[model samples]
Target: MRKIIVSAAAAALLASGSVAFAAVKHTTGTIKTFDATAMSLVLDDGSSFTLPKTFKDPGLQVGEKVRVSWEMSGKNKVAEAVKIAK
Candidate 1:
């Protein structure tokens, strides 16, 4: 019984650690292109992100500086939020 409890605790710890590693990441750069119809954007530094279906446009445009909050989903960087930057 004690061994089983310890094993469960270890498993839980590993799960929590993975969750922490998967936390949202942020990037800032000038917008190279934004295709609202395609729900995607690329930064001048060559980073690309796919906007969520529920994402609202914040008037993104080429050459605009913006910050993107995102996370990796498979091979894609999925954007959680986008905010225009100064």
Candidate 2:
């Protein structure tokens, strides 16, 4: 009975921890620069993101407003998607 309670508690904690780590961050701003070669972009607000190697161009352009979905990898914010914003 005690072992069962402890196992359940551990499982609950583990589930919550996984949910916390699975969070996808988001940012919205005008693009300041874009480099297809580097697979990166900088926002006018100074935020920068590294795009995935398989990323396809979304017709991004400087001064265009955008919404970026991303996740943190080491010290970099790796972009998962970039969408043109109205």
Whole-model lDDT values for every prediction:
0.96, 0.96
Q: Could you tell me how far off, in angstroms, the CA of residue 48 lies in candidate 2 after the best superposition?
A: 0.8
- By summed lDDT, which 10 consecutive residues of candidate 2 come out lowest? 17-26
lDDT of 2: 0.96
> Which consecutive 10 residues in model 1 have the weakest lDDT in total?
52-61
**Superposed Cα deviation of residue 12, candidate 1 (Å):** 1.5
Cα distance off (Å), candidate 1, residue 68 = 0.2
The count of backbone overlaps in candidate 1 is 0
TM-score of 1: 0.92
State which candidate has the highest TM-score: 1
Cα RMSD for predicted model 1: 1.1
Q: Per-residue alpha-carbon lDDT of model 2 for 9-84, expressed as tens digits?
A: 9999999998898699999999999999999999999999999999999899999999999999889999999999
